[model samples]
Target: MDTLHIVCPACQTTNRVRNDQLGAHPDCGRCKQPLFQGRPVVLDEAAFERQRTRSELPLLVDFWAPWCGPCRMMAPAYEQAAALLEPHMRVAKLDTEQAQALAGRLNIRSIPTLALFVGGREVARQPGALTRADDIVRWARSQLATA
Candidate 1:
Protein backbone atom coordinates (compact mmCIF):
# COMPACT_ATOMS: atom_id res chain seq x y z
CA MET A 1 0.00 0.00 0.00
CA ASP A 2 1.21 3.48 -0.83
CA THR A 3 1.40 5.90 2.09
CA LEU A 4 1.79 9.65 2.23
CA HIS A 5 2.62 11.89 5.16
CA ILE A 6 0.32 14.87 5.41
CA VAL A 7 0.71 17.76 7.83
CA CYS A 8 -2.43 18.89 9.54
CA PRO A 9 -3.06 22.59 9.04
CA ALA A 10 -5.33 22.89 12.02
CA CYS A 11 -3.23 21.05 14.56
CA GLN A 12 0.16 20.79 12.88
CA THR A 13 0.17 17.05 13.34
CA THR A 14 1.71 14.70 10.83
CA ASN A 15 -0.65 12.04 9.61
CA ARG A 16 0.30 9.04 7.52
CA VAL A 17 -2.37 7.85 5.13
CA ARG A 18 -2.74 5.35 2.35
CA ASN A 19 -2.52 6.92 -1.09
CA ASP A 20 -5.63 5.13 -2.27
CA GLN A 21 -7.63 6.43 0.71
CA LEU A 22 -7.02 10.07 0.01
CA GLY A 23 -10.06 10.61 -2.20
CA ALA A 24 -12.14 8.38 0.00
CA HIS A 25 -12.00 10.75 2.99
CA PRO A 26 -9.06 10.00 5.25
CA ASP A 27 -9.02 11.58 8.68
CA CYS A 28 -6.15 12.90 10.73
CA GLY A 29 -4.66 10.53 13.28
CA ARG A 30 -4.50 13.21 15.93
CA CYS A 31 -7.51 15.37 15.23
CA LYS A 32 -9.84 12.80 13.76
CA GLN A 33 -10.90 15.27 11.09
CA PRO A 34 -11.18 14.72 7.39
CA LEU A 35 -7.88 15.30 5.70
CA PHE A 36 -9.24 16.72 2.49
CA GLN A 37 -12.37 18.57 3.40
CA GLY A 38 -13.77 20.98 0.81
CA ARG A 39 -12.62 24.06 2.72
CA PRO A 40 -9.07 25.27 2.44
CA VAL A 41 -6.92 24.48 5.47
CA VAL A 42 -5.41 27.46 7.17
CA LEU A 43 -1.68 27.31 7.74
CA ASP A 44 0.74 29.45 9.65
CA GLU A 45 4.43 29.86 8.87
CA ALA A 46 5.65 26.89 10.86
CA ALA A 47 2.87 24.63 9.69
CA PHE A 48 3.51 25.67 6.12
CA GLU A 49 7.17 24.89 6.47
CA ARG A 50 6.49 21.48 7.94
CA GLN A 51 3.97 20.58 5.25
CA ARG A 52 6.25 21.74 2.46
CA THR A 53 9.24 19.89 3.80
CA ARG A 54 7.67 16.60 4.80
CA SER A 55 4.83 15.94 2.42
CA GLU A 56 5.45 13.29 -0.25
CA LEU A 57 2.71 14.67 -2.47
CA PRO A 58 2.64 17.87 -4.47
CA LEU A 59 1.02 20.87 -2.80
CA LEU A 60 -1.32 23.48 -4.25
CA VAL A 61 -1.46 26.68 -2.22
CA ASP A 62 -4.12 29.28 -2.82
CA PHE A 63 -3.08 32.72 -1.64
CA TRP A 64 -6.18 34.83 -1.31
CA ALA A 65 -7.92 37.64 0.51
CA PRO A 66 -11.34 37.33 2.09
CA TRP A 67 -12.66 40.56 0.61
CA CYS A 68 -11.66 39.87 -2.96
CA GLY A 69 -14.53 38.87 -5.19
CA PRO A 70 -12.45 36.73 -7.49
CA CYS A 71 -10.88 35.00 -4.54
CA ARG A 72 -14.31 34.16 -3.18
CA MET A 73 -15.43 32.88 -6.56
CA MET A 74 -12.39 30.67 -6.87
CA ALA A 75 -13.00 29.11 -3.46
CA PRO A 76 -15.51 26.58 -4.72
CA ALA A 77 -13.30 25.64 -7.62
CA TYR A 78 -10.38 25.15 -5.31
CA GLU A 79 -12.47 22.98 -3.00
CA GLN A 80 -13.64 20.90 -5.92
CA ALA A 81 -10.09 20.47 -7.05
CA ALA A 82 -9.09 19.37 -3.57
CA ALA A 83 -11.87 16.82 -3.42
CA LEU A 84 -10.84 15.41 -6.76
CA LEU A 85 -7.08 15.37 -6.20
CA GLU A 86 -6.97 14.31 -2.53
CA PRO A 87 -4.50 11.45 -2.03
CA HIS A 88 -2.50 12.41 -5.09
CA MET A 89 -1.87 16.01 -4.01
CA ARG A 90 -1.90 18.16 -0.90
CA VAL A 91 -4.12 21.23 -1.26
CA ALA A 92 -4.10 24.24 1.07
CA LYS A 93 -5.06 27.88 1.27
CA LEU A 94 -3.40 30.89 2.85
CA ASP A 95 -5.17 34.14 3.55
CA THR A 96 -2.97 36.90 2.18
CA GLU A 97 -4.38 39.52 4.50
CA GLN A 98 -3.53 37.50 7.58
CA ALA A 99 -0.36 35.88 6.36
CA GLN A 100 1.30 39.19 5.52
CA ALA A 101 4.79 37.97 6.26
CA LEU A 102 4.39 34.90 4.12
CA ALA A 103 2.93 36.97 1.30
CA GLY A 104 5.80 39.42 1.52
CA ARG A 105 8.35 36.64 1.55
CA LEU A 106 6.74 35.08 -1.51
CA ASN A 107 6.42 38.50 -3.21
CA ILE A 108 2.78 38.01 -3.89
CA ARG A 109 1.31 41.28 -5.08
CA SER A 110 -1.95 39.82 -6.26
CA ILE A 111 -5.11 38.97 -4.32
CA PRO A 112 -5.62 35.42 -5.60
CA THR A 113 -2.42 33.69 -6.51
CA LEU A 114 -1.86 29.95 -6.56
CA ALA A 115 1.54 28.31 -6.08
CA LEU A 116 2.52 24.72 -6.67
CA PHE A 117 5.18 23.33 -4.39
CA VAL A 118 7.08 20.08 -4.45
CA GLY A 119 9.76 18.85 -2.05
CA GLY A 120 9.57 22.12 -0.14
CA ARG A 121 10.33 24.38 -3.10
CA GLU A 122 7.97 26.32 -5.31
CA VAL A 123 7.63 24.98 -8.85
CA ALA A 124 4.95 27.24 -10.35
CA ARG A 125 2.71 30.13 -9.48
CA GLN A 126 -0.56 31.28 -11.03
CA PRO A 127 -1.34 34.96 -10.83
CA GLY A 128 -4.87 36.42 -10.91
CA ALA A 129 -8.10 34.74 -9.85
CA LEU A 130 -9.82 34.44 -13.20
CA THR A 131 -8.38 31.02 -13.95
CA ARG A 132 -10.68 28.02 -14.34
CA ALA A 133 -10.48 24.85 -12.25
CA ASP A 134 -9.54 22.69 -15.21
CA ASP A 135 -6.70 25.02 -16.11
CA ILE A 136 -5.48 24.98 -12.55
CA VAL A 137 -5.62 21.19 -12.45
CA ARG A 138 -3.70 20.98 -15.70
CA TRP A 139 -1.05 23.33 -14.42
CA ALA A 140 -0.68 21.33 -11.22
CA ARG A 141 -0.35 18.11 -13.20
CA SER A 142 2.35 19.72 -15.28
CA GLN A 143 4.21 20.78 -12.18
CA LEU A 144 3.95 17.27 -10.82
CA ALA A 145 5.60 16.08 -14.01
CA THR A 146 8.58 18.33 -13.36
CA ALA A 147 8.90 17.12 -9.78
Candidate 2:
Protein backbone atom coordinates (compact mmCIF):
# COMPACT_ATOMS: atom_id res chain seq x y z
CA MET A 1 0.00 0.00 0.00
CA ASP A 2 1.19 3.51 -0.77
CA THR A 3 1.49 5.80 2.22
CA LEU A 4 1.64 9.55 2.29
CA HIS A 5 3.76 11.40 4.81
CA ILE A 6 1.67 14.00 6.62
CA VAL A 7 2.80 16.34 9.37
CA CYS A 8 0.38 16.74 12.22
CA PRO A 9 -1.09 20.22 12.41
CA ALA A 10 -1.35 20.07 16.19
CA CYS A 11 1.78 18.16 17.14
CA GLN A 12 4.26 18.69 14.28
CA THR A 13 5.03 14.98 14.25
CA THR A 14 5.02 13.25 10.87
CA ASN A 15 2.35 10.61 10.35
CA ARG A 16 2.35 7.99 7.65
CA VAL A 17 -1.16 7.65 6.23
CA ARG A 18 -2.15 4.94 3.84
CA ASN A 19 -3.55 6.26 0.56
CA ASP A 20 -6.77 4.28 0.99
CA GLN A 21 -7.32 5.69 4.46
CA LEU A 22 -7.00 9.34 3.54
CA GLY A 23 -10.71 9.95 3.33
CA ALA A 24 -11.45 7.99 6.53
CA HIS A 25 -10.60 10.96 8.74
CA PRO A 26 -7.09 9.91 9.67
CA ASP A 27 -5.71 11.00 13.04
CA CYS A 28 -2.21 11.83 14.10
CA GLY A 29 -0.37 8.98 15.75
CA ARG A 30 1.19 11.36 18.24
CA CYS A 31 -1.45 13.99 19.05
CA LYS A 32 -4.55 12.10 17.87
CA GLN A 33 -5.93 15.15 16.08
CA PRO A 34 -7.86 14.72 12.85
CA LEU A 35 -5.54 15.21 9.90
CA PHE A 36 -7.86 16.84 7.39
CA GLN A 37 -10.32 19.06 9.19
CA GLY A 38 -11.29 21.10 6.09
CA ARG A 39 -9.62 24.19 7.49
CA PRO A 40 -6.32 25.87 6.95
CA VAL A 41 -3.77 24.90 9.55
CA VAL A 42 -1.92 27.74 11.22
CA LEU A 43 1.81 27.23 11.38
CA ASP A 44 4.80 28.77 13.06
CA GLU A 45 8.18 28.84 11.36
CA ALA A 46 9.44 25.52 12.69
CA ALA A 47 6.19 23.69 12.16
CA PHE A 48 5.89 25.28 8.73
CA GLU A 49 9.31 23.91 7.83
CA ARG A 50 8.32 20.42 8.92
CA GLN A 51 5.10 20.43 6.90
CA ARG A 52 6.67 21.98 3.84
CA THR A 53 9.79 19.82 3.78
CA ARG A 54 8.72 16.56 5.33
CA SER A 55 5.23 16.00 4.00
CA GLU A 56 4.69 14.43 0.60
CA LEU A 57 1.57 16.50 -0.06
CA PRO A 58 1.78 19.73 -2.01
CA LEU A 59 1.59 22.72 0.32
CA LEU A 60 -0.11 26.06 -0.27
CA VAL A 61 1.00 28.70 2.20
CA ASP A 62 -0.62 32.06 2.68
CA PHE A 63 1.79 34.56 4.12
CA TRP A 64 -0.18 37.39 5.62
CA ALA A 65 -0.21 39.94 8.42
CA PRO A 66 -3.07 40.77 10.77
CA TRP A 67 -2.81 44.51 10.26
CA CYS A 68 -3.06 44.29 6.49
CA GLY A 69 -6.50 45.09 5.18
CA PRO A 70 -6.14 43.05 2.03
CA CYS A 71 -4.93 40.11 4.03
CA ARG A 72 -7.92 40.34 6.32
CA MET A 73 -10.29 40.59 3.39
CA MET A 74 -8.76 37.56 1.77
CA ALA A 75 -8.94 35.42 4.90
CA PRO A 76 -12.41 34.04 4.35
CA ALA A 77 -11.77 33.30 0.69
CA TYR A 78 -8.59 31.50 1.60
CA GLU A 79 -10.46 29.43 4.16
CA GLN A 80 -13.04 28.55 1.53
CA ALA A 81 -10.25 27.53 -0.81
CA ALA A 82 -8.85 25.29 1.90
CA ALA A 83 -12.13 23.40 2.08
CA LEU A 84 -12.07 22.90 -1.68
CA LEU A 85 -8.39 21.95 -1.89
CA GLU A 86 -7.83 19.58 0.99
CA PRO A 87 -7.27 15.76 0.61
CA HIS A 88 -5.29 16.59 -2.53
CA MET A 89 -3.17 19.38 -1.03
CA ARG A 90 -2.58 20.79 2.40
CA VAL A 91 -3.44 24.44 2.94
CA ALA A 92 -1.78 26.46 5.67
CA LYS A 93 -1.37 30.01 6.86
CA LEU A 94 1.73 31.74 8.19
CA ASP A 95 1.33 35.07 9.89
CA THR A 96 4.00 37.52 8.82
CA GLU A 97 3.84 39.26 12.19
CA GLN A 98 4.48 36.04 14.10
CA ALA A 99 7.02 34.70 11.61
CA GLN A 100 8.82 37.87 10.62
CA ALA A 101 12.12 36.12 10.07
CA LEU A 102 10.51 33.49 7.93
CA ALA A 103 8.72 36.16 5.89
CA GLY A 104 12.02 37.91 5.39
CA ARG A 105 13.72 34.67 4.40
CA LEU A 106 11.02 34.07 1.81
CA ASN A 107 11.43 37.67 0.59
CA ILE A 108 7.75 38.41 0.96
CA ARG A 109 7.34 41.98 -0.23
CA SER A 110 3.57 42.15 -0.17
CA ILE A 111 1.01 42.00 2.62
CA PRO A 112 -0.61 38.85 1.23
CA THR A 113 1.37 36.30 -0.67
CA LEU A 114 0.24 32.87 -1.85
CA ALA A 115 3.05 30.41 -2.43
CA LEU A 116 2.84 26.89 -3.72
CA PHE A 117 5.51 24.48 -2.50
CA VAL A 118 6.09 21.03 -3.89
CA GLY A 119 8.81 18.69 -2.72
CA GLY A 120 10.03 21.42 -0.35
CA ARG A 121 10.64 23.99 -3.08
CA GLU A 122 8.46 26.95 -3.92
CA VAL A 123 7.12 26.45 -7.44
CA ALA A 124 4.97 29.54 -7.84
CA ARG A 125 3.84 32.60 -5.93
CA GLN A 126 1.10 35.18 -6.20
CA PRO A 127 1.64 38.39 -4.27
CA GLY A 128 -1.83 39.78 -3.76
CA ALA A 129 -5.07 39.11 -1.96
CA LEU A 130 -7.22 36.74 -3.94
CA THR A 131 -10.72 37.66 -2.81
CA ARG A 132 -12.70 34.99 -4.65
CA ALA A 133 -12.68 31.36 -3.59
CA ASP A 134 -12.93 30.13 -7.17
CA ASP A 135 -10.04 32.34 -8.24
CA ILE A 136 -7.90 31.04 -5.42
CA VAL A 137 -8.75 27.44 -6.29
CA ARG A 138 -8.17 27.94 -10.00
CA TRP A 139 -4.88 29.71 -9.47
CA ALA A 140 -3.64 27.02 -7.09
CA ARG A 141 -4.69 24.23 -9.45
CA SER A 142 -2.97 25.91 -12.39
CA GLN A 143 0.22 26.38 -10.41
CA LEU A 144 0.21 22.77 -9.31
CA ALA A 145 -0.43 21.58 -12.84
CA THR A 146 2.53 23.55 -14.15
CA ALA A 147 4.72 22.50 -11.25
TM-score on alpha carbons, each prediction: 0.85, 0.97
Q: Best candidate, TM-score-wise?
A: 2
Q: Residue 126's C-alpha lDDT in candidate 2? A: 98
Q: Pick the candidate with the highest lDDT.
A: 2
How close is each model in CA RMSD to the real structure? 2.0, 0.8
lDDT of 1 by residue, 1-147 (tens): 878888766677888888777777777889887767665567767777888898777878999988999999988888777766666777888888887998999999997898989888999888887446677777788878876
What does candidate 2's lDDT look like per residue over 1-147, in tens digits? Answer: 999999988988899999999888899999899989898999999989999999999999999988999999999999999999988899999999999999999999997999999999999999999999999999999999999
Model 2, global lDDT: 0.94
Candidate 1, which ten residues in sequence have the lowest lDDT sum? 35-44
The parts of candidate 2 lying over 4 Å away from their true place are none
